[model samples]
Target: MTSILPLILFVVISTVTPGGATTLATASGANFGFSRSIPLILGISIGLASLAAIAGLGLGGLLLEFPSLQMGVKALGSAYLLWLASRIAHSGSPNAGKGLAQPITLVKGCLLLWLNPKSWAVTVGAAASFALLASTPNRLAILLGTMFGVAACMSLALWCSLGVLLSQLLRTPGHWRTINLAMGALLTASIIQTWR
Candidate 1:
C-alpha cells in the first residue's frame, strides 16, 4: 500500500525518461510507422521485465560484486549505441531504394534491452529498494517486473506515437535525414549519460 507508492513512482519516472529503448521506439515508429514498430515495443517490454525479475532474484548483487563484468557490459552497450547512432544519422528516406535502412528487429530490440546499462541500473535499483516490502525476494521481483512492464509499454507507445505524428511533417529526403540525425544525436546523448 503505502510502501508501494515509491516503487510506483520509480517505475513511472524511469520508464518515462528518454532512454535507449524509448529512443529506438521513436525512431522505429518514425521510420516504419506504428504497426511495424509493434515487435520492437513488445521486445523491449518483455526484456525489461525479465531484467527486473533477474535483479529481484539477486543476480544484481552478483553484478555489483563483479565490477569488471559490469564494466564489460557497459562497454558493450555503449559501443552498440554508438553504432546505432551512426546508422540513424545516415538513414535513407522512407521511400528510398531497397537498400534503405530497416527498422530494428525483435531480436535486436531484446538484445538492446539486455545490453543497456541503464536498464540494469534501474531494475537493480528498484529491486533493491523495494525488496523490504515483500515477504520474499521473488515476490518483490515479480511485482516490480510487472509494474515496469506496464509502465514501459505505455511510455514506449507514447514515444512511438509522437514519432508517427512527427513523420507527417517529414515530406522530403532532406527532412528525413535531418530528423534521423537528430534522433541519432539523442541516442548518442543517452550513451553519454550512461558514462556519467
Candidate 2:
C-alpha cells in the first residue's frame, strides 16, 4: 500500500489536469449536459486504459527505439488536435437550438485519446514508472489499465460536472460561444505543451 501511493498520486494528478480530454468533456457537458456526455466520458476512460495496457506491453520501449515512429505519431496527433480545436471554436451553442447539434460520439472520443499526445505521454509514463507494481508485463498492464480507467472516469466526470454548473450561468448563445472559443483555445494550447 505504501508503494502504491505514488502511482495513485500520479494517476490522480495526471487525470485531473486540464488537458484535451478534460476540456472536451467540460465543453460537452456545457453544450449537451451530463447524460449526453456519458458516451464520450466512457470512451475516453476506456481508450486511456487501453493505451496504458498497450504501453505496458512494450509500446513505450518500441517508441524509444524508433524515434521516427514517435515523431510520426506526434505529427498526426498535432494535426488532429488542431482540427478538433477548429471544430470546437466554430461550434454553435446547444441553447441556440441550432438543429440540435449532436454531441461528440463514443467512437470519436476514443479516437481522440489515440491521437492525443498528452494521453500517450501519460500512459507511457505510467507504464514505465509503475512497471514494478506487478511481477510481469501482463500483470502490469492490468494494473495500469484498471487504475487509469477508474481515475480518468472520476476526474473527467468532475470536470463535466463543472461544465454543467457553468452552463447554468451561461444563458445566452453569445456567452456559450465565448466559452466554446476559450475551451478551443485551451485545447490548442495543450498541444503546445505536448510539443514542449
Candidate 3:
C-alpha cells in the first residue's frame, strides 16, 4: 500500500488538472462526442503507457535533472494546449460534427501524449511507487511495472469519461466556447505553475 503512494499522487494531480491529455480529451468529447472519443482515449492510454515504459526503462531521470529541458517541454505543452483550445473555439457549432464527426485518430491522440509535459512527469513519477517494478536488475520489478501500467490505463478511462459528461451537458456552442477557453486557461496556468 505504501509503495503505491507515488503512483496515487501522480494520478490524482495529473487527472484533475488541465493538462495536455485531459484538455484534449474534453475538446475531443465536445467536438466528437463520447462514441468518437473512444479512439482518442485508447490512443492516449497507449501513448502514455509507452512513455511510462520508457521512463521505467530509464529516461525520465536524465530529463528530470535538466531544468532547462523540462522548462522547454512545459512551454511546448502550453503552446499545444493553446492551439487545441483555438481549434475548439472555432469548431463550427456545438452540434456541427454530430452525425459526421470523425473519430479521434490514433496518430493525433498519440501525438498529444508525446507533446504533453505532464504526461512525461506522470510516467516518470509513476515508476517511483513500485520501486521493485523499476529495478532493472530485478525481474520481479518488470512484472510489477507491467501491472502498474494496466491500472494506469484503467484510471485514464475514467478521467476521459468526465470529459464526455461535460460534452453532453454543454450542448450549446456558447457553452462549448466557454469550456474551450477555460480549459485553455487552465492549461496555461498549469504551465506557469510548473515554472514557479
Q: Pick the candidate with the highest lDDT.
A: 2
State the weakest 10-residue window (summed lDDT) of model 1. 92-101
lDDT, candidate 1, at 172: 95
Model 2 has a clash total of: 0
lDDT of 2 by residue, 96-115 (tens): 65422777788888888887
Q: How many clashing pairs does model 1 include?
A: 0
Instruction: Give candidate 3 misplaced runs (Cα > 4 Å).
Output: 1-18, 65-68, 97-104, 133-152
Report model 3's TM-score to 2 decimal places. Answer: 0.72
Name the better of 1 and 2 by TM-score: 1
Comparing candidate 1 with candidate 3, which one achieves the higher lDDT? 1
lDDT of 1 by residue, 1-196 (tens): 3468888889999998887788888888888899999888888888888899889888877778998988998999899889998888788667774222677777887788888888999999988888887788888778877998889889999999988988899999889988888889999999998888
Off by over 4 Å in 2: 97-100
Candidate 3 Cα deviation (angstroms), residue 129: 5.3
Q: What local distance difference test score does each model get? A: 0.85, 0.86, 0.63
Question: Which candidate tops TM-score?
Answer: 1
Q: Least accurate stretch of 10 residues (summed lDDT) in model 2?
A: 92-101
